[model samples]
Target: MANDGLSAGAAARRLGVAVTTLRTWHQRYGLGPSRHEPGHHRRYTVDDMVRLQVMQRLTAQGVAPAEAAAWARRSPGTDPAPSDAPPSGPVAPADSPDPALRAAAAAARESILSLVESGAMIADVGLGDARAGGGQTIALGPRVDPAARGLARAAMRLDGPSMRYILESAVTHRGVISAWTNVMMPVLIGIGERYEATDRFIEVEHLLSRAITEALSIVPRPPRELTPRVLLAATDEEQHTLPLEALAAALAENGVPSRLLGARVPSRALMDAVDRTGPAVVVLWSQLPGSGDVTQLQHLLSRPHPPVVVAAAGPGWPLADLPPTVTPLNGLAEAVRVISTVKA
Candidate 1:
């Protein structure tokens, strides 16, 4: 009733929804008002409460949370009418969209999605084919993309040898992770053309992913006395373990001890590992969309125990509607940052 702010818990109570549900709406739909904090607790304004009410109404009517949030933003009487209802300005000549560009973009997106779904590896489409015509040789390496290079520079400061090893492994292995990285090279080149248009980098990419996964599996765990322990693994349906394995290596490099549980770890085994290790974090890697049983996993995660931080990576986590407690691991560098921050 008042415009005064309410904490997330209070607001959730007023809306009669679970706190996880509220946080999900906030993250997915951007429905909540700006958060202001005094000390460390989050507080939401009256506007956010109003939006939540509207969201509830729309959701009850079968509208998705994202669509409901959009509706709430544009509802009548919420804002004044625009000054120009219809512009009478001269219109520029309209040109037809390029079918070739659209096709290329679609093809690239399809390739990436298919690779993730099928667990297809990446292969090097040798630049020799393109270079035979006397064109400049396209360079391929770990820091191949400028953005990835920038990230590498800022994060780990990977040297030429390390970068080369990563790139070579990815190109040769054809693992899904490796393919994603290699494909990123051409995808970056065709950014203006849309993500779907880039050529497939299947074989070498998959090889790289597999190699990374294998390397991480062999990397020794850190000493137990160094810091609080953590367990890293993938969900049962998640065959992609490169991301989690990378995180495990990062933890070892950072002096935080962790056990790499490898890929396709069942929930029972994961819980058993947790019970045995008493870890501070449980990192789960899931790259493929709709591949893991998130609902059941969440129920497992909610149980009382050593307060565990669940870090999720890849495309699957975002679609799983995970609780805010489960943080998204974006990249190798980000994984390091999160673990370091938590340890500190």
Candidate 2:
């Protein structure tokens, strides 16, 4: 960050985009570096950085690249407004004669502005203020994986594409367990904490949850020839099913197919599912206190044709009250191991 400007690499890093993306914007959209020194590579000045930031934000919100660039080119002056500063007005095309288009533009402007006003678009170039617990970023701690930070920034922006990209990359390269334990879990917990503190960002939570579900579902399932002997379900009235989703994905990663009976499953429904499926292993997940009724576990244990292994997962379950015959799964890896071993 010289007095002159920043290089392409530095600019891209600051914008959380790739150098090639900057190149595309420059060549195709004409949103390139404007500052240059004698015999030196062209550098992006503060103004150019502002334009690129606008472009990044708009495109992340599903606007077309060409349209986003048009808006970016219209960004005023060199400096972006401070995070806490009052918004000047709607940042849309008020001049547009088409009323419908203008209305849509205004809506988009408000969406972005709301995120900024909420401190989710904080001043730090990385989109994270480096400290945890703010509504703006998920605090993954000092030693968090880069992927987690990337995911957190994307989540803050409500940028579905970027979030899915980071998640898929982690699952593809690191495997589901590592992705869940090292990357996804830390950020998920951080977001949960942020929600508890601020009681805001429900949109962030919903979108992140959907993105994670999509990413996990992308893991290839076992071939049709393999019968899935593992059945997974949430406890009665339990709405937190991401942990079970992670478990299901981890099982698939190990070539163990499973039936996932998603959130808020009634007790009778679960038992009926068990009776019909005749699964060799049944895993019930409970994420909150009220949802982890010991009777649910008891019902499974008392079933006439009970599965050989009945496992309890998630923190919702009351460990002290769990039937002695039920196995408790501690983590994603352990759940996978315990269930997979039984299936094998």
- Number of backbone-clashing residue pairs for each candidate, in the order shown: 33, 0
Q: Give residue 60's lDDT in candidate 1 (0 to 100).
A: 37
Estimate the lDDT of model 1.
0.50
In candidate 1 the C-alpha lDDT for residue 333 amounts to 67
lDDT of 1 by residue, 1-344 (tens): 22335666656654445567666666665555455557755555444555565555444323445555555444432321122122122221222263322232233334334543563322211112211212212233544544233223211211222333333333334433343444333423332232234443333344434434454454455666675567788888887665666666656666677778887888888877777777777777777676656753574576677435677766676554777667777876677777766742
Reference-based TM-score of each model: 0.42, 0.65
Off by over 4 Å in 1: 1-202, 210-221, 224-228
Look at candidate 2 and give me any clashing residue pairs.
none
Residue-level lDDT tens digits of model 2 in 1-344: 34556777666655556677787788766677887779998877656766776676556434557776666665544333222222232344526564433333344445444545675444324432222222377777988786787688788867686688678867887899999988788878988998899898888889999999999989999997988899999988888889988988888889898999998889999989988989999899988888889888888888998899999998988899888999989998888877877833
